[model samples]
Target chain A: MKLDRRAFLGTATAATATLAAPAVMGSARPHVVVIGGGSGGATAARYIASGAEGAIDVTLIEPSRMYYTCYFSNLYMGGFWDFDNLGHDYGNVALLGVNIIHDWAIGVDRDAKTVTLASGPSLSYDKLVVAPGIDFVDDAVPGWDVSKQSLMPHAYKSGTQAQLLKHQIENMREGGTYCMVAPPNPYRCPPGPYERISMVAHVLSERNPTAKILIVDPKENFSKQGLFEEGWARHYPGMVERIGPDFGGDRVEVRPDDMEVIIDGQTQNVDVCNVIPAQKAGKIAELAGLTNDAGWAPVMPADMRSRMDEDVFVLGDASHQGAMPKSGFSANSQATVVANVIRGELTGSRIFPARYSNTCWSLIATNDGVKVGAAYEPGEDQIESVSSFISQTGEDAELRRQTYEESIGWYNGIVDDIFG
Target chain B: MPKLTFSSILLAGALLAPAGVFAQATPIGDAEAGAQVYQRECASCHQIGEGALHRIGPHLNRIFDRRAGSYEEFRYSEALSRQGRDGLRWDLARLHAYIENPRALVSGTRMAYRGLRDEKRRADLIAYIRAYSDQPQNIPEASPTALRAEVELSEETLAIEGDAEFGAFLSAECTTCHQRSGDHAGIPGIVGWPQEDFVVAMHAYKQELRPHAVMQSVAQRLDEEEIAALAAYFENLGN
Candidate 1:
């Protein structure tokens, strides 16, 4: 019989009492209720359930029957990975004995340690993990809000809107204008709008080379600015342009049907408008009263638990605990932290803390991809990047091939981390 | 699985008690189950020689007792590197803690790997990472040449001076699409180009014309003066 001393200690202690020493188990495993089966929530559910099998009851509550990734949908707009590659079934999670409930978490009674769902069902948990993804802040942009999403089509959240943007692009004849307005600081996928422009340009170059892609940006420059611009030019020449706030692109206005995007003092009519409206946490956060004045939840970094409530943990695109953009990679990374902390807290064990990593891949064109990646460690209160890298300026055959290849690998890896 | 006689196991530890045995006995993790975890979560990010492939993160060759976040090429988050440089190594106990919540341990890190809070999963992931313990450090793997193009272009910038003709040639095609003065999607107006900034930009483009299919051909035709003229042209447009 071989017995490791480390295992010996764990079993000896665990034998006497469940990890939750104070909270007695109901004859089964300790209940771990997870909200939002997106990147963070899904990853947490998979890891926790798989790791502790019978030791924990992992329940995941998600609104959507099928989850759609905001990542790579740009490529979908450009016709890259099919919906299958990006779409994930939660069966893998179900195989791990995790109760995957397709429902939305509407209310959280922190005092009672209860979660009320939209369907009038309630679940209690010894520990809770929340990874509800981003919420678009409609009020941030005047004259532009959720009601206007139908017209403007931010396409930031992905799904049907992503298809709608494609429809808009295909509908526009050559020589027509296509405009995209970017949000200010602290937005999801900072390099996203640029990638969308590049992809749209790629599509335009194929369908209508004479067509144009105009970017009305809030910032002077965007993430991986050099690489994106280079890719845009090499792949789709004369199809794209960028304007900034200082140059009259600030607080831009758009009329969807008429096809107009205005910045500063000037207004212009065009064929299509894709404005990525300001973003916050998803509606669930606001509904639960977890959002602050800025429309994002602030949390204690130790466990990514919201300041608004202790029993509840808010993560992914919703929380403002770390200094990182709201991307699939970052959200997936954040899920790891939240899952670990909840596991430790439930078991009364000391939690191991580590750094976070965010590597976002943006496709400038079909095979031309640029990546903005960074390695970050949690700061005193924020997550700060230590080293960052982006795609090179020129499109050498070797780099182009590698970037393209890596983009696929990145996609597959992220998908597995969540639904796989 | 053979049933282990309890007293004999205890006696074995007592009899073979080696000095400096500080190994903490933790819960049992089925290595077989851990192996699945290894393949799913770990093998993606870590490279354990043949079985492990290189992920965006690091190769976990001989990762145990390895300093925390001390990979040279991987360029760790300042926070992790600082701690590793501070003399922390990945012992089992520490490994468990880090796998759970990396941020709670080290701030300013970018591992993005959510800690495997499930002790069993942590054990499995650890087992997977530890499988490379005997292997040597896989150091300084050169980046594929294509990945370095951005680095090369980064060295050459668009150097501008006060010249409208060069700016006009530089931005000639620009005005055809971009409003030389308005803001909107996909169009960056070339109004008020800073002289020095314009000069640098043209030189960059003239070198390759701007790292794209269109810009490369466009900048190739322009002489250095044409680039400057374009810089000056845009500089004077708004001013």
Candidate 2:
């Protein structure tokens, strides 16, 4: 409810940034503070800073030393992709005259309307856009704790844990256990666990065909469920098994070690377990007091501004997107929405959001890909999809080729948006 | 000061200001330079020069004066095509604005390229399209614009009627690349295109169907049903 000095300073900085900008475009534009220079943040920064050159200002804030995309993280872990392929740099944001600040958020003072970075500096905004992406609720499970993350690394957000999962996949011998506990419904990248298994099974089958990959799930259905399960049955049968919560498979009381997963009334021994424990907004969201009891911030449709904070807008995995699972693409699209809204606010214009699109591609196998996508728009108070698409069913050789080509194309394309 | 001297000074100032603001209309690059760039960048999907064909997007032969979404075939995203289905012509000014930075000009479009931002580059590109266009020569002269406008004046005489001749004036940009051939590559020629499919596709793209980043970029600029008029016009053209 009240902002500290840093938060106050951030707000003051925004005002200064706003006022300092010439009302008229004499080549210098209004500056926009885009927190989380990921897909959404970077695109907004690039467009406003460059496209509207002499008309807008753009500053990007991201904490990652390097951007490791979740899009192809599964491939990277499966040994099919190199880490560098998924990594992106912020130089493009910088090239466009966008201020790229590599720092995390410590607090957001709604009253003063400022964001206090972990670096202790503050940034004010003509408008503030938060595409901070998703956060893991390390303690989402009743008995689980953050210190025990080593035992169950979600590896979902990419970067360090991504490498952790990759190393485990490499070292584990044949007949070892690969337990990946899926989250309840509405998590980022719904088809992720299924796709991860497919990718792992493909790699493991060739190296260690005897390895059993068990998926512990909390939901009966998933994104493109029919398509994913179909691929498993056709290619790697019995090697990849999913434990349905209703069918005597417990979600997870606790995983004391990477070697075991407890389900129903038994302890299943595991070799390398990847428990994608449930997620909410990142820690900064909680620190900024943006979450409701569910650990998500509610916002008006399309613009993604928190209903509680008008000057503040949230996008990506951080916002409660309802059925829209958090993925970089979704995050990026939401970023476009919020960025457009911020621009409109800065320039005094009306918002015209006819639609927004999200397409998530999962590398089910080394050379194969599966996808589930949807296009959304502002419904009354929230955004909803108007049309959805899925990767064609039954791996036609052509479909498979298209999938791989599309995946590569998408990666290059999105990378272009992020850093190009 | 003499009255003549003051008057002369005022006239000189007026002439210099616009010269100062507009700077110089770009001439270093003609539509020829624009043609080369378009061939290198946009020709893969968009038809830009003489006898243009769409690889992915619609032809841009005479796009200068066409309405935003008035094309009959080569389904445009509902977003951009919707803008002129109601007869909103793509005048030089609007075309330049859209070509500069599509997403800024229209949100919710699927066109992925950030748009060519250099004003001179854009003007040169448009000029190139104007310079290289090879539109239909046999279509007889008819007042498509007036018929459509007169229908609008009546409002009830013909439900959403447009002058085939006048609509053709607006349709020049569209027809150049449309059915210039029965079907070119993957794009269907407009000769026998079904208006329903054409309209629906525009709506879909406007609404985000066939969501290509580039299409999304352009579609977001158009509105609904402007899509319909373009569809109606195309549908009337002998299947």
Candidate 3:
């Protein structure tokens, strides 16, 4: 039950015929090129290379040498986690015989099975994995874009945005308002926006109790709504106010230049505005012609193969995953399945059944943590949840503390698993 | 139900004599009729007689007065595990509720059966299961053995040798949170345990005996050989 080198060499030669990539053709093993070195792509590359054991050549293309995870960015915002702990390098990933290319993957030629990098190199691949997390939809919010991120600061993506948002929160006026225009449904980390709100409330309650927190949310409900509400009432009473869609939250506009939020044509001055607009798959997936009408790449239920292209797979937040939230845990779980399937196809390894699970732990205030998780299996058309659980609202302090501690452990374990 | 045995009278006497000072006396339901209920509902997943091996579920020997999900050899659901860790014991009252509706007792339990709804049948089933368990009141004398059928397993149960190569492939799921360098800062290190211990622990998780949602989900998906393979791979890592 093994695929020999000749079969891989035959496909490799055919896939690279149009390109002048000698390294790929000369190599005896198959090549797997993964784009975006976040949780999905990094774990995929590491697993394939390690599982193949020299039988396959894996290359990972990511723009940043050090990846700062979005999972714990909220913790950093709340001053619970150090910023340095959120970053991980690909040194150990490179040590595992994976070709680490710190370059942006500009384009993918599905016809030629080649990935064109921004630094002027086109690498051919037998299989391509696209894990470019997400990009904000164009003009989803009026007067909001990545360029004005310095002013409004989406802080949605990893790295500098978080730092910028934190700086703004710290230096805000004593009684100034901190407004967050939360995104709609199908966004990465369903509990993320609420968690961010909790973090912001935490910082404000401690520093400026008089300062107000305004949540201009588009949706009527959010992840762990009950638990977050309970914690807010108990810990930061009279500090947080959420305006759902009923009060014109959906029809909102932000003027970054004037530093004002217009909710249903009524303008309100705010000190800091965190605009998390509607999101879509990263631009590269759309460029690769893998995205659908919904701004996400539809993937096969079994292995996350892009429905548009067989050779290409879309993982993580970019993927329109059913019954699985777009989170780092979900992405990492999917990446392992992708790696196993890719290895089985290219190197003739044993392919196990795809099993996916995700657990999101959000810290409400200090040691008050809540979690929701589910086990998923591939159904006929989409991934279906088999079992699930969510933390109760009235949980005791000890369990909450343990949940928070477990999250830290999980963070360490996932980063180690991804990078190494 | 069969006529009350001589020990039942003595047990009833013991419970009634202390009622003025302690809790009320409840009949230890009919064991003979309960044996039928066990055959119909519980036998498919659980085993209770002598030499009962860990099958789909853990052997139910010595279940009374035992901590919930505490059998090291069996895998219990994370829900059950947490309840056990939260000081839940398999007392008569708790057992009745669990048998009546498992999910009501533990939300994420993996026990697939819809539960025995009949109160009398449930009580009978509990009585049947209780026969194999330790009785604190009967500590001086050996507890009576059940008249149920025995389970004889081959000497070479789980005898399949783990292939380290396959284990290496499987270790991808584990190493995500557990460092390969075995630096257990927040998560416990999984490297370098005895293969047998590893196998047993994984089985406990697979059986859902161990707590932790992610671990239970991950372990439940793995087959017996894969567990062995992972055990062998993790045991030999960095050596």
Candidate 4:
């Protein structure tokens, strides 16, 4: 296999180090291994490598060559955004002296300070950052599994599933019902399911106005509930309906074979079913023994360091940090704090106090966007929201349009920040 | 008469001067001409007389010597707001430059007017607006006499040397929305800004003098030294 300059140097250094004492390894540059190159992992890897300026080595292992963000997938479904715009590559990220490996990281050997790859080689690291985003819990939704994903798509993870779901929506029978099975609390993107419902309504209102939409939500309340309810009432009136946990929304079971939803012991036929199951940390974190009984990796509020392993940091949706929602913005924020702490530990870089913030924007209809945001600070037990703001229900159209335009701007800014 | 010194002579002249004359400075242009200019140019979007409330733009009352975007209730464009936070006050020189060409002073200002090109007309308009402001002798803290030293930055705070390395680390948070490459679509670019402008703008956000939620949240957590470091780092970035 052809090797790059850094890889050749690493190999040569390894060979030379075999003849020297084990203590010589301490003198080498500290190596940071980052797993899962989404918002959290990618930002952390970029910051640590760029901030160190050749003082430390970083290797990022991600399975996919192109990362499709989940943040704007709903917009894509709504025909408001281009699907191609959701994809970003690591070409610029690799330029900052990081070893970018497009391979799966299968196991973590924490005691040995090494990570095993799906391809056969085991790479060693001084510190490891696990940012694998999320995995659906088994049997969280009865009669549903990943194998049945083609029949009833989750469309949650970033990939072809979003495309499949959009295709299904487009090809749906005229005047047919579209039912959604929303997940419980503590999921990625709190307003995501409602936003998806809005997008579905937007598409159907144009194609088949008679088509009805049903939501099976387990939570009592959702993010931007008032704003969304008002928009739905005004924009797509009588087209959508919702059932909360109090009304048997909590009792849900999906049958992909027959395309039916069983809610409150009542069977309803649907043309398209979107099932978003309860989630947990990605499987690799569990393999690393970093997850707790709740199937999430608990982290220190200050730095997002794994409570189990000081050298390992868990970020993004997989991390159970308090107050901050599991979002791309929050992940990016936490990654900056993680990068600063890690760089300061390895090299003598100045470590600033940890600060985190997050803002989530959602679109109800064309030029009708709403946002909720909070500033976070580390409290005694967890990260707490210091200040927060949400869009008002009765805001004028001009403000909503401005908010939508700002969301577009934010998308451009964040993608540039992440990929570059 | 009794061996009066220069100070005593000046004091006698001041005492003999007409009351309320020294309360206001000499108008830069004819007030009557300026009133005509205001009617012709600015009457549609702005109002300057007593009891003027916010219209399309903020009410121009007390606008002189006020921070650029400090009329917090109004929804100004991000570009104008950023400049205001960057220590752009409505003084004679700055207001002159702005009225001459709004875009030249602040790029992406949402002021739809092209600009007043005639130097005489712009001065007249500014003189008319300056009538609404409290005189310098009345409000010393916010007066046109304080030019570059308008904002509340102590000499010691400005003197603190910034560490570029630390700034680079902190800038990652900012760059999540504000591009480092100076490509600003909706959010304004912060790259290559003057260090003092950056510091002053950040302090404005920290103090809630500027009105942007994300910016305020980001700035509130940063200390004085961190702000300086970020200012230094962004100032050195190649656009």
Highest DockQ model number: 3
Supply DockQ values for each candidate. Answer: 0.01, 0.02, 0.30, 0.30
Off by over 4 Å in 3: A1-25, B1-157, B163-166, B206-208
Off by over 4 Å in 1: A1-28, A348-350, B1-239
Q: All predictions: root-mean-square deviation over Cα?
A: 26.3, 19.8, 10.4, 9.5
Tens-place lDDT digits, model 4, residues B109-187: 8999888878778766766676676544322112463223213567888887889978887787788888888887766
- Please give, for residues A1-420, the per-residue lDDT of candidate 4 as tens digits: 113324534553554343231221333677798999999999999989888888888889899999999999999999999999999999999888777877788999898777877866666777899999999999999999999999999999957999999999989999999999999988999999999999999999999899999999999999999999999999999999999999999999989999999999999999999999999999999999999999999999999999999999999999998999999999999999999999999997788888788889999999999999988989887899998878888876756776787788888889888896
Error of 3 at A372 (Å): 1.6
True contacts kept of 4: 0.55
lDDT of 1 by residue, A150-268 (tens): 77788987888888888989889779988887888788887888888877887888888888888887787778888876776667767777787778777677655555666775779
Q: TM-score of predicted model 2? A: 0.63
Candidate 2 per-residue lDDT over residues A92-166, each given as its tens digit: 567777766677767777665556777565655556776676676756554456566666677888888888787
Q: Estimate each model's TM-score.
A: 0.60, 0.63, 0.77, 0.79
- What TM-score describes the B chain of model 2? 0.42
Model 4: which docking level applies?
A: acceptable
Q: How close is chain B to the truth by TM-score, in each candidate? A: 0.44, 0.42, 0.52, 0.53
